[model samples]
Target: MRTQTLLTAMLIGMATPAALAGPAADFRAADANGNRQLEFDEFRVFVDLRANGGNAQAKKVRLFKAYRLALGKVDYDGDGIVTGDELIRFDRANGKS
Candidate 1:
């Protein structure tokens, strides 16, 4: 019984992040002008995700830089723009689905 309970708890813990990740990504994508791709200005979403009840303002600049790199990498085409199709392709290629 204890082993079963432990296994269930482990499974739930592992699943939680994956479940939460989608919603967060959706939220960020929406705020990114409905493009489903993130831009530098959209860094706010990621910043909000990483910020806690502490030092949010302090972390702003660093988060912006990190978000820039992250967004750049995901843009993939280097066209200075990202489309919904591109995002979907990226997600699939990265095994998001």
Candidate 2:
């Protein structure tokens, strides 16, 4: 628990934005391989299994579009993928303290 707290603190400190995005747990889960990054594949699963609830096949046809939107929204580097730092910054900018 202590480690987790530290990690969360680190994440928040690293974040650059000022609004809440999603919970840290959400980002951690979405970041497969624990690489602190979310490739389209990881983002896809995260989107489908988000707290809102949805199935993988439900948005198969629109995942690509969603990816593009995600890029525009949080992929600050425009590197075709979402990083933990970028997401944290976005989250903070949105509302997360």
Best by TM-score: 2
Model 2 whole-model lDDT (C-alpha atoms): 0.53
In every candidate, how many clashes are there? 0, 11
Residue-level lDDT tens digits of model 1 in 28-84? 553556655546565445444434423243144344444444445446688655444
The local lDDT score (0 to 100) that residue 75 gets in candidate 2 is: 72
Model 2 Cα lDDT, one tens digit per residue, 1-97: 6543333333332232223244345556767788877788876555544423432322432443444454455677788788757766665665654
**RMSD over all Cα atoms, model 1:** 11.6
Q: Give the TM-score of candidate 2.
A: 0.51
Candidate 2: give its CA RMSD in angstroms: 12.2
Every candidate's lDDT: 0.43, 0.53
Task: Please give the RMSD to the true structure for each candidate, in Å.
Answer: 11.6, 12.2
